[model samples]
Target: FLTAPTMDDKIKREILPAAVNYYQKRRLVHRLNPQPVTEIAYYTAGGGCLTSSEAVLRPKAEIQRLRETFADGSELYLNFSDKPWVIGGRQIEPLGFYASGPGFEAETGRKDGLWFDWYGDADGCFLNARNYDWLMEPKGTAAMGRGPEGAEPQFANRGDAVVKRGPLATDTAVAVMREADGSRRIRFFPQKQMGFVSIDLAASGFEPAEVVALDAEGNPVAGSLDGVERGSGTLTIRHRDPRVWSFRLTPGKGRTGR
Candidate 1:
């Protein structure tokens, strides 16, 4: 019997490289026409790349004739350039900037998860995944490169909530939230004494509310809520020990019990 080719093999040998070449050619044409370049690239194993000009150029009736593909996992490479780019019709800035080099490879379908190996200068490669509907970094890696200032990556929809590290927040602190209930949760596991860590709760559909803190055992703790703004709230979790904490925000006054 013969073993079938894996998704990683298909991606390395065909999918990703094909995408790079397709975009490179499309970019070349856009350079001459000088139209706004689409910054986002979507890839799936079954449906190679969903956003393609070829489909757009076809007639409405013939558009469905275009091939469709899907993948077990999806990967989007953002912030290749320092210009504004649009994805799904929304303008977004590049998450990071890196120079081109050799040995650039990305493979998925691994039991551990996706693997991206590349040789380049990723000085500004750090990004906040919460800005988008679906974005995640490789596990066991920092938002920035491996450094003292790096943060632990966050996964989507964990425990009915999505947690995101603040832009300047380190791995020691985290922003936990459950969007459906419109509440905010913060926890601290600091290495040394720190003043406070401000977490952005806008992306998780957070709203201003009567904030309360809870200890590891779910008991109320003393804390405060500040810097409340439209579609955003900043919670200051101050600590000096490696303890777990959480905050809950009631959506409106006299409305209790989340």
Candidate 2:
């Protein structure tokens, strides 16, 4: 629990609000009871020096096998031993980021993965990805929020809530959660200051002949869909509002039969 800052005015005014918001978001994740929650995962590599084990060139593949760690984004820890007698240096490829897939990457590697040029002060660092804020802090961060339960859940419940989700391609990270009621809770921070996003919904069984943006309280917000003029297939949403948006995708025009 985060208490309001009672000290410096700067701390009280600036930091407390953010803390409160984060706490509220965390509570929201808890309230989505019986749903599968994803917590930030940390993967460790580089114990080969002690055991003299084989070097691992593909830590990403190892992390993949440990999918149980986190369903969404996670942190990869690459440890480097500074021992004077260690041979060659424990090396591993942090595969959290790849051009073809979604994964984590160390923030320090702004343009590429962490590499040793042999002149640096030290080796190994706990990395926060460039998208760490989007992946961990935000209430809807896929890595920290609840996701649809998995197939053959070990403790499956008869009344657990369920949701559907689809992958999206965007310049930056976006969080999406499809509810049991066919509504969508989206967390998209437009890379551009203006509000303009094209969603692949509103077509077929996706829901609603038309779509509208709603605030968390279910009040309609000022927004528009390209479908009004363009057609149904690629519905583009233009809303200049908050980063998090909720939409009701019911009253669909998709296939109902067969």
Candidate 3:
């Protein structure tokens, strides 16, 4: 969370000068939209630096002093809309937060490193020195990836779908659903990249005796499926580029489907 502007504000005063010099040296523009850049920053208290007219260059030594002065005991708060707010035909929303220095900690008890809070609603993802993970509490689903020092920063979710990229190269997307007819489906999207995605279907409220994979156009794609603890199942999608894919899980033989 953020507070109103403070009185001991030398550091905040330096922002204007640094930004003016930085932008004048090199003009910046929106990468995806290709529009003339106007806004530099947006905050709760005020819209950020509007123009570069009064910009000045500060000495490196002075800048370093300010950096050290403001490094400790600082909290940055950001507020974003839960749904998309479109301007100029682009969807902009608060998507991620990155933290550094010695202030934050992971649930697993790690310290003094990078931690990320991703997502906007009940469904979102997170990455830190401790681990890379995703969770959707309302749906009772979660997933995690293992990387060296737990710095893997590639995962996202929207609603029931989870997207991830593993060590090889391929990307995978999965969504679990329960149909009106009391059957269940796990939708999978596999990209051409070289990697594998492991999806857990336990939390979506279905347990499977067998699973089958199919392409977007209703063609079967070769893959492997196996059951996990608690009668749930894991789908390992590997080395395929079917534009849209899904797996329909069959309830345990002679058991009612969820």
Report the number of the highest-TM-score candidate: 2
Q: TM-score of each candidate?
A: 0.30, 0.34, 0.31
Residue clash pairs of candidate 1: 45-70, 45-71, 46-69, 46-70, 46-71, 47-69, 47-70
Candidate 2 structure quality by residue, lDDT tens digits, 1-258: 113323344334442233323322222223233334253232333332221122244443232211111233322233221211111242333222211012212211112222211000011111111221211222222332335333222111122111111212222223334445555444333222233334444321243355655666776666433122234455544444553244444445543211
Where is model 3 more than 4 Å wrong at Cα?
Answer: 1-171, 190-195, 199-202, 219-244, 253-258
TM-score of 3: 0.31
Pairs in steric clash, model 2: 204-254, 205-254, 208-250, 208-252
Error of 3 at 70 (Å): 38
Q: How far off is model 1, as Cα RMSD?
A: 17.0
Q: Which of 1 and 2 is the better model by lDDT?
A: 1
Candidate 1 lDDT, 1-258, residue by residue in tens? 012223344344433233332323222222223233223334332324445654465444332212111131222333322233443543333232122222121211111221111111111011121212121233323432433322443322121222222222322223343435444444332223233444444433334466565666867754333222232355445554333345555566544222
Off by over 4 Å in 2: 1-167, 190-195, 201-208, 222-232, 242-244, 251-258
Say which candidate scores most in lDDT. Answer: 1
lDDT of 3 by residue, 1-258 (tens): 122223233333443223222221111111112222233333221223212232234322221100000224322222232222333333233332222223221111111222222111112112111121332121112221133333433323322222331111113333344445454555432222223445444422345666566566756555433222232255454434444355555667665433
Ranked by TM-score, top first? 2, 3, 1
